[model samples]
Every structure is written in C-alpha cells, then in structure tokens.
Target: MHKRTKSNIAVMLVLALCLSAILAGCGHEPDKPKPTKNVVLISVCSVRADHMSCYGYRRQTTPRLAEFARQCVVYDNAFTQWPKTTPAFCAIMSAKYAHNNGVLRATHGPRLADEHVTLAEVMADAGYQTAAFLSSPALAAHSNIAQGFQNVDEVFVGPRRAVLPTIRAIEWLRKRDPKKPFFIWAHYNNAHYPYRASGIPNPDMFVEDQFYDASRHVRALKDPRAHLKADVPRDHPCVMEILRPDIGAIHTWAVLDERPEELDFYIARYDAGIYSADASIGRLLDELRTLGLLDNTIVALVGDHGESLGDHNYYFEHGRFPYDATAHVPLMIRQPRGAGARHVSTQVAAFDLAPTLLEMTGLTPPEDWDARSLGRLDKDTPGDNLVFTEAGYQLDYMLAVHDSEWKLIDVPNALDRQMMRHQEYELYRWRDDPGETRELSAAHPDQVARLAAILDEWAAPWRAEVYANWTRNQTTIPTETSRQLESLGYVGSNSSEDEEGDDGGD
Candidate 1:
C-alpha cells in the first residue's frame, strides 16, 4: 500500500510540474498595452468666430459648441494663415506659412508640394493610423492634400453636410484597431455660401418679406461678375429692384443704403447653417462618449476661415480680403482625461495647431516648422506677437501683418485694373476700429513703413521660390471636381493657369 501511494504522488508531482511550465510560458509572452489616446480634428468651413454664442454673440448658434468649450482651451483670437480652404488647410497640416508650402492660390497652379511634411505624415510615422474625410472638393485627393493619409473619403454624394461625414467617421472609429492610436480629420462644409436653412431652429427670427425678394433677385442675377466678383453697378436693374421701396424699406431704416438690411437677411441664413453644423458636432461628441472613447480621445474644433458677412463691403463669403471678418477663426482644444477648461486670449495663428497637437501627443515637432506649440499658453507663455496673412488668388495679391493692437495690409498691384484703383496700403488700429473702416496709413506713416519693411523681409524668400515652383508642378483638377468648385464660386477655366472668368477670392 505504501509503494502504491508513492507512485500516485510521483504522477501528481509530474502533472503539477507540467502545469507550472505552461503558466510560465504564458507569463513570458509580452502583454500589449491599450492605446492611451486618440485624436479627432473637426474643421468647420466658413464658420465665423463672432457668430458663435461662446464668443459673446447673442445668437445661440452654437449651444453644443458652448458646452464643448467648457472642457476645452478656447482661443478667442485665432487667425488663419490664408482664408481660402486649400491654403489654410495646408498651413494647419504642414505647420508652415503659405509661402513655405507654396500654396498661394485657392486653385489652379499652386498645390501643396511633396517635399513638405504634413501632419498626417508625422502622426503616421509615429505609429498612429491617419485618415481624413473632406467635404470640400478643393481638398480632393488629387489636390495632393491626401499626402500621408492611409484612408480618405471625399465622396459624400450631396451637399457637403456634417451628418454623413460624422456618421462615416464614427463608423471608422468603431472599426479602428483598439490597440493603436489614430488621427482622424473631418471637415464640415455647412456654413459656406448659398446657405441652406433646412432643419435650423428659429429660421424666421430675422426674416423679412422684402429680404426674401432681394435674396431671390440677387440669386437670379445671371451676371457672375455681379456676385462676389466685384461691386455691382449701382444703377443695374438687380440693384434697383433690390433697393426699391417694397424691398428696401426694412433694409434702409437701419443704414442709408439697402446693403445693410440685405446683409442682415444673408447673415440670418448663415447663422442657421451654423446652428445646423453645431448640432451635428454635438451629435459626434455624444457618439464618441457612447462608444466609450471620449475620455481617451483629444477633440479639437476649429474653423478653416470665417465668412465676411458684409465686412469691408465684401459681402456673403470669405478669402477675398485679410480683414478680421475672414482671418479670425475659432479654435477649441479638449485634451484627453478631462483636462480642465481654460480660455486662451493670446493671438495665435492656425499653423500653431500642428505643433500644439504633436506636443500634446508626446511627440516632438520638427525644429524647422514655422508653428510653435501652445502647450504653455495657459501659463501665460510669451510667443512671437506677429501673425502673418496672405492671399494670392485672382482678385489681388495681398500681404498683411498684425500684432495685438495694429494691423497693416499691403495690396500689391492688382491683377485686374479695376482693383488696382483701390489703395495699395491700409493701416488700422484694429482695437479701436474693429471694422477697419478708417485707414490710418496716412496718419501713421512711420508705422506703415515699419510694417511694410517687416512684410517685405518676411515675403522675400517665399516670393523667390513660389512662382517658379508653381509653374513647374501645376495640377489639372478633374472635370467633375472643377464643376463642384465652380458651384461654390471657385469658377475658372479648365487650364492649369488661373481659371478664366474666375475672379478669385473667398
């Protein structure tokens, strides 16, 4: 009996040893750590900072954004490198000025060169999955805007609304590798011109019967030149009809001309579109939370550019001028793990976004990048006060520089003779005269010269290389893309040069 017991014990000991060896092998294998963070960049096109309620606007156009801002670092004064879509996005992605990226124009010749490193490239190189869902045809894959994105979806069938894109983004997020980080860029194109008021709350708040007539008449005007190309003839039938007593009465009561009231109506429509966009964003945020990804994700909301809304006599759209109306955009950043909300009033450029995001993600930005991280902005960190802007489309070549209190705009000889007749230099104490109605150039000759010198020195290197590079690698957009751009007032001929009859601006 004792011998039998010893044999049984030996057999049991061998089985225990086998089990211990198996457990040790399993423990030796490395355990994969869960990805700590994800990034979602939401770019809202043509969204004016002033229109949002959080920016002191009376309208509740962005209740959702207002709530989101509570958990974000809200930037009250954020400016774009260029007001147009392509150039502005390039600046954000490349962390470079328009000159460095060599994308001066909205379309036609200047495309984002291959040499420059994009934000997508940087993230992808760092082992993050990069994807982009663009609503604007101006940012199509062929535009070289798809440089480092592993996946790009620009094929939303109808008017580029936020709903479809947001849905697609959520779906992509659900399928993304749980163990890997991701960088997703989604562009919302709702606040653009030809504003659709469908599904907007309180669409009739600013509605006037005559305003509708004026809007319809303005839309019916066949002459493309009358719309955004240039100032319409005061005596033209469209103008006369709009200014007629039946249509102009409500408009003329506030301002001497019909323009002020007409603009009021247009602004109402624009606000409605903004409201819709805000709702869509709220939906996206909610979905992220529902999917248990909100806390681990970094949410950034910004505008590519703002609409003019009749500022500087340039009505309806953006990209035409360098006024605060178009240049100043809203920027909001929500860090992972519920970082507390803070408002940053420092004047920062859109290019700073790339570096800021990189630093936030525990990555190092390239030293040569024009953008600097705003990581210490909450600590009252001091940075370069100067913000530069440029526009080189068909209207007029413009360069501008602005500090906290002053702004200087230099319009080189216009491509069109009519535009050339306008002033070549404009200086404004923007703090006092936010409208930029008063030109202080003559009054402040010394300041003008000083700013001009700065601009010239800054632009010299870019000017030397831009034209040559643009001519060397011009991209011809597809016919379908051209038609889409034309519908959005980016009309031009099909040639590699400037589109014919394309009085480029916003």
Candidate 2:
C-alpha cells in the first residue's frame, strides 16, 4: 500500500478502538462494593401526599413536584409507617417499623439508638459529607432527631416554614466542595397548619404557596344541621359562620366547603409554601446543573404521610382516624437520565423508601429492615404484595392494616369524635365504602379476622413489648420519636429523655 493509504488505515483503527472504549464505559454500572459519590434526600414536611396535584388534588400545589415526578418513579399506594412526624421519620431513618423502635406518637421519638443506621450515616461513612438542614420545627432542637449529621443545622427558620431553610441550604450548597460527595436532608414544614391564609390573595384561585392568608369567617363554617353531629343551636357559631356572605374571606362555601372551598383554600396555601419550596428546589437543581452535578445525582421525593380534608368527617387534619384520605400518598424516584424512569403504580409503601434509597445508592439495608428496595423491583415488575402499617396506641389510638384493594380499621374503645363523641369500632371494607359509612366487621368476619390478626401480629412482635411500657408509664417525655408531641405543647422539663439515635456502625 502507498504511504498515504497506510496512514489512513491507522487512523480508522484508532477511531474503532476509541468507539469501543466509549461503548464499554456506557454499559458499565457505578463502582460496586463502593458508594456512588453523589445523592440527596429532600423531604417536604407536613405536605400531604393527596394535597399535591400529582396525587389528584384539584388545585396545583406542586407543579414542580408533579413535573419532577414525571422524571422519576411515582408510587401510588405509598404510606407512612406512622402518621405523625417523629415516629414516621424514626421508621424511615432507621428502616424499622415503629413497633421495633418503640415509637408511637410525637413524644415517642427519642434520639435514635446509637446502634441504628441511617441513610445519612451510610453515605457519610462511605465518604460523603452527610449534612442535614432541618427546616421543619417538628425536627428541631430539644429532640434527638439530628443524630446523624456532620452539619446538624437545626436553625430556626421563622414559622417552621421553608423560608429560612431554603435560604440556608442554598448558601451551603454554593459554599460546599464540588468534588466532595454529599448527602443532604432538606426538610420543609410549610404545609402543616395555619394554611398560609393571609397571602393567598384569592382562596378560589392562587399560586402555589405556603399557608393561605385568607380571613376566617363564621358563615362559611356552618354546615347542614344533619352534618353537625351534636344538636348545635341554630345560632351557634359554626351554624352562623357558614351563613356569612363575606366575599373577602377564604370561607367561600356557605355549605361548609369541605373538599371544594376550605380544601381549596388549604391547597392554595400549600402551593404557596410549595411555591417557595419549589423555588428553593429549582435553585438547588440549578446549582447542581451549574456545578455539573445534575446527571450524577439520584433524588427521591416523598411524603412522611398524608392529610385529610373532610373525606370521612375528619376535617383539615390527619391521624385523627384510620382513613385512606390520610394514608394513601405519592412517592417519587428519579435516577439519572440514562438510568431510565418507570412509573410503578403498584402497591409500594413509604416504608419501602429506606431500603430503596439504600439500594439505589448501592447499599444494602440490614436483614432486619422490613422494607424492600425498589432497586430489587423491576420497572414493570408487579409488586404484588400487601403493605402493612400500624401506630402503637399513642396520641391517637387505632389498629390498622391495609392493602391496595381494602383496609380494616379497629378503633377499640373510641366514641368521642371531634374531642366530644367517644366510641370503639371494628370497621372493614374501607375501599368499597371510603366514607366508612358502613361497618362491615360483622359482614366480612374472615377478612376482619385476617387483617386484625396482621395488625396484632405486627404490633405484637415489633411493638407490644415496648408499647406496654409506654401505656404503663405514660411519662411526660414522649416515646423516643415524639417531636410531634413536643410541637403540640408537651412542655415537660424532661431533658433526660433518650436522644435521637445516630448509629453509624458499619
């Protein structure tokens, strides 16, 4: 061959080798037996799963989250182990059920035991900067909640909202090392109570924001006499409130805007909070993109639990009773682009979150974790299993076990609903009767027995031993994971309570 021809042939050979190397690189997964250097866990506190547009709420409280969900795996039947904050997170952070952790209500959340392992500690041990910006007051000071963070930022953001945390986190992200990997827990609590009523501007129509600022009125508080459980006088405050004609107030539905008006106001305010949250999130995402950290990161967004807006007589709150309005929630998962995204509407519980995060970050949870990793679940693979959840009789006492198809609620020795009516219950077939208008314990005896047995068994092995202790003592100090109790005005000077656990034993 001529000299020029030989040179050309050499060039082709080199090009072919280069192409091969790139192809191999593309096929290779991240270093196994080793942690991926970059991942983040951001929790939106007090934001119910159902309140977001992604979860079928009428108002668009979470446009960004909804969009983000498209890029991630969204779980339909996700549920929080415990409804309230401390215990719910105790289960999530430790990957254990409330029963095992001996956590029931707000005060129940003590410092996690030093033996317990957290995703933060896992990432931190694997050489990631494990930091937490506890935005929610629910997990703030005087609690053992910040057990596993190098940056235990329990900074008091005003109103337990996202304003301060958002600002602080953005600043921290900007200052942190780009090459050093990190595990950040950015929590927001703007969606809880007070509903951002003032700045809502328009209760009927408003941007996604935190807390509505609309004025409360009497006319809108009134409902039908039949709707009122008690024989409230015709001129009672609730009756009179619903009859008001004030167009300025958020109380629009004179008929008691359960889902339509009041719920609308609630959603609008949630959006405002989410608006601020989304702005913060967008800023963080932008920073990642600017730092070129976008593609290398894995982000998972989820609710600790859900909220209720008069689905079954429980209005504007949760954990009041065993109802789907407060249990069913949205769970989102987004890996890098080439990683592919699949929507798994199958029955996956939020308890599955810990193991899933661990597995996604290339870490396996301990054998004791009842939760399962989504990394183990195929995209279209049917997760044909019933999820089990229970709350050790704490702030509110009820035994519950549910599947995608149905749920059974047992409110033993309960009658005073609304802090007035007290009664006990053995209810079943909640899926068919969402309002729980019918109690079918007598009808589906076998199902009730099976479900009740599961709840008992789960609570017995994991919870009974510890709960028996709490039931007996009922101390001023809550069960280890009791932030919610503290938030609710439990001002016992028990600084001697157990601290939040930060076990990083490898």
Instruction: Pick the lDDT winner.
Output: 1
How does model 1 fare in lDDT? Answer: 0.70
> TM-scores, in order shown?
0.79, 0.72
The CA lDDT at 149 in model 1 is 89
Candidate 2 residue spans exceeding 4 A from truth: 1-33, 197-271, 274-276, 379-384, 392-396, 415-439, 471-506
Backbone clash total, candidate 2: 59
Taking the tens digit of each residue's C-alpha lDDT, what string does model 1 give over 1-506? 99999999999999977877787788853433333578899988888898889787777789998988989989888889998788898888888887777676565534678888888888888889988887777787656867888999884336434466687788888898888899998888777655654334564554553434454322222233332234445532123212211111221111212243454566766777788778878888998889888878889988888977656545565565778888889999998655967887778887798888887787778877898887756565334578898863432367888877788988874432233226778898876886678888889999899889989898886665564444433577778776665543344422212222121222
Off by over 4 Å in 1: 1-35, 198-220, 225-261, 376-383, 394-396, 414-421, 464-472, 489-506
Mind giving the per-residue lDDT tens digits that candidate 2 earns over 93-191? 777776665555544224455566766666677777777877544565444545667887764324434455556666777788776777777776555
After TM-score superposition, the amount by which residue 279's alpha carbon in candidate 1 deviates from its true location, in angstroms, is 0.7
